[model samples]
Target chain A: MSAAATLIAAALGIAAASVLALVSFPARSVLVVAVNALLGLPPVVIGLVFYLLLSHSGPLGWLDLLFSPAAMVAAQAALAAPIICALVHRSLERSWAEFGPPLRILGASRLRALPVLLGMNRRAIATAILAGFGRCLSEVGAVLMVGGNIAGHTRSLTTSVVLQTSMGNLETALLLGLVLVGVSVAVSAGGIALGGARL
Target chain B: MRKLSLSLAVLLALGGAAQAESIVLASTTSVDNSGLLAKILPVFTKATGIEVKVIAQGTGQALATAAHGDADLVLVHDPDAEAKFIAEGHGILKREIAWNDFLFVGPKSDPAGIAGTHDAVAALAAISSKHAAFVTRGDTSGTDAAEKRLWKKAGINPAGADWYRDIGGGMGAALNAAAAMNAMVFTDRGTWLSFQNKRDLVALVEGDASFINRYDVIQLNPVLHPNVKIEPARKLAEWLAGPDGQREIGAVAQGGEQLFHPDADKVYVPGT
Candidate 1:
């Protein structure tokens, strides 16, 4: 669930960061600060808000996405997107400052320069995706609230660890916790390999 | 992988959430943590072709979810809150499916000497006077509601007392906290029996009539929300109250001890 959800957040974050880099909107600064600030949004609050939105009586209740892996993915994506956006936007904005005026002089539109700038900042974008994936992998509150933590269906590694710890199987819980850390380590190593270790 | 994209598609589709195949049941941690639902839910699903997705939380939270029309049914143990739910027209087709006793467990040393006490009220007063370290669920769970009632009856408030620790967690978490502090607390026998971190906490007071924990099943009202899967919900309620359901519930045991007593045979009706 985390991998798949992180991928969706990556797509969204990359797009948002590219827009923030290429466009010169009046509210760009406010949105940039907002994205950076929202990196700390509590997963539980996101879960609760989504829970209400997907509730049977809520406006989006017709979607019937609550208490499923899909809802959890949505919550995870909401959490990871801001991190990806903030981190990637930092790199994109830096490179855009250096390349923007020259590219515009050469008759390239902001829309056309988007892909060029994104490609130039590949390492930063990759690091941002890794950070986003880490956030998704570690979060428990949001998924627990929205996913319902159904054993086989929506129970992810972190939620299972929590359930085990609360169940008093501290040994098993610790083992699962180690496995979670191991997954993060393995994924981080993979990210460094693919993106280089400049971060 | 299929449910992944399907979930997104449904979200974007903004269409009616497909069919009435599976139902979401809001339940308590005791039911889920005890492994009871893990055993019987699949069986129930097989027999009825209706999958039940359980959201294991406290009774208060579960009731809140059902009140918001988020759950199709509720399998909870707090009768007072269940009564309030029904009175508020949030529930119907209520049935008493099982029973267990909540235990006052503390360090085996019996810090407040509450051991072997049949009167739970007197034991609370004793614990209060002795300033025994007590951990409360404090999360408005079923056990918390019962504990609050017992404190009210004992006419002593331990709210500000340092010996009182409100962990504000589920049954298992509260038990773990109590065990760590050697604090006395109330817990359902199901969770206590299944819990592995006993450390030195033992049942100090039990078998009191006040400690009886009755588990009930209530399906959400379909009239309030036309989209509710009331048919499957009603089927689940009847199954739990029926012979086969009771047998399945009774068959669930841990550590060679039965955790819950199936009491669907003794169903409760209003007034009489």
Candidate 2:
């Protein structure tokens, strides 16, 4: 879930961040603010919305993704995209000031400079995507709401831990919780290593 | 980056499409959480070579999933919902696979003095009159449906009452919450038997005919849901009600006592 959702979120987030940094639209600041505000949206609410959408009765029910891992990936990606977008936008805005004028002087279009900007801030963008990965790795509310937490199917480390805890297997739950923490910690370390210590 | 995304997407599609021939079974938490499936599902798969992917949810949601064609079949315990589902042509077969009874599990204090009572309705009324803390699984699960029926029998709404607690979660969650606050909770015997966190809770009421939990295995209607894997699901339903499956179900014991009494042979009517 973390890997797939993070990758998908990275693609969408980077595109959104490029628009925010490159474009001079009237509501650009509003969109930036909106993406930032979306970070405050509880994962549970996002999960519920996706649940309604992916349910057999929902509009997108024809996809037949409900109670499937694909549905979970979609929910997790939706949950992580905003976080990646906002953080990448913050980093892109800083570097765009440096890259924008030079690229414009070189007779480059905003779309053409998109790849150049992405290459220049690859480390920081990697950092933002990893942050989104960690969020997806640890998120249970949205995953459970959409995944149905099916045994041997949609069950994940976090949802299983929640199950064990409710089953009064606190010792097992604690061990699983440690695994989750350890994994996220490892992801953070990997992000730093890949980002070359860039934030 | 494009190569990476493509591979990841392929990996995800593979993950989701694992064992494509498998049948999805939507069941109640009580059946799955009781650890009975762990003992029998492997054997069932080995005998049939058809995988059954079990997704445990509330009976309400389980049936709803099958109705939506998201699930091929359901193994659940709510008669009212099952009847409605059959009436609506969402499912067919409806063979009784196992049976258990609901137990009034509450704090050992016996605040309402319901221990040893066989009359669930009276016990509930006493609990309501005394205003004892009663935790309810308001998530529309099988046990929650039974609790509602009991409350109605006792002529008490208990909706806005201070003593009533609606946890709106699964059976395990409701039991955990009940254990936390030392509140009374009505739960199926299978879950109650496997529950390890006794804490201050005890069985307050039992042996009521009204609390009998009959689990039925229903196949998705082939006529209505032409997309369902009806053949494999039907084979599974038959195997569950067959001699071998019934033996396995009845043999599953928790705390040195059988959790479920197999009722498949005793009562299964065709085309009902």
Please list all clashing residue pairs in model 2, or write none if there are none.
none
CA error at residue B195 for candidate 2, angstroms: 0.9
The DockQ assigned to candidate 2 is 0.49
Task: Report the lDDT tens digits of candidate 2 across residue range A6-122.
Answer: 778888887888899889899998999999999877999999999889876678876667777877888888888899899889878887898789989999998888888888778
Using DockQ as the measure, the top candidate is 2
As a whole number from 0 to 100, the lDDT of residue A170 in candidate 1 is 97
| Candidate 1 structure quality by residue, lDDT tens digits, A99-123 | 9989999999988887788888888
lDDT of 1 by residue, B25-70 (tens): 8999998898888888888999989988888999999999888788
Candidate 1 deviant stretches above 4 angstroms: A197-199, B1-20, B266-272
Once fitted onto the true fold, the runs of candidate 2 whose alpha carbons sit more than 4 angstroms away are A25-30, A56-63, A194-199, B1-8, B266-272
- Candidate 1 docking category? acceptable
